[model samples]
Target: MDGADYLHPGSEWAKEPDDIDSIDFSPTVTIMYFADDDTWQAVWGGREQLGEFEGTREEAIAWARERCNTIRIYSPSEGDIVDLVPDE
Candidate 1:
């Protein structure tokens, strides 16, 4: 606590949040492009390949936005983990 930078597990600085829903939770949806198929897939939870959906990039984005509040589209050029739906 002296340094006032590090947060220990049980330290007072790490108090439990009162509003859990307000937290910026990670996206449970991921849209990936398959070059072999020339289509995009909207994967649920992770890259485990669950809940398949094949479409164009715009169509995939629309599909993801309709079903969930957040989505992660795979960006090869940019950095990983760019949320389609950022926390307000």
Candidate 2:
């Protein structure tokens, strides 16, 4: 199917989707803002998330920095992105 055996079901090549929520993705730290609740989130190692009133952009940046000296801050809404800590 689709000219690809991998795309054919029961071809021993098709597999069921894995549980992504149980899997960790990127291994970097990044901060994201939620304007609706005025909350900032710091995603740590893509494994955990911290969301709290320490939620301002500055606060979020600080929080991220404390845990990881090198982190990335990006704003999709403002089209702004900057790697606050330069790579060494």
Top candidate on TM-score is 1
Stretches of candidate 1 exceeding 4 Å from the true structure = 1-27, 45-50, 79-81, 85-88
TM-score of each: 0.53, 0.47
C-alpha RMSD values across all candidates: 11.8, 12.1
lDDT of 2 by residue, 1-88 (tens): 2212213344322344477575545555666555567766666675555332247778877777667665756554433444666531
Each candidate: what lDDT?
0.60, 0.54
Q: Total clashes, candidate 2?
A: 0
Question: What clash pairs does model 1 have?
Answer: none
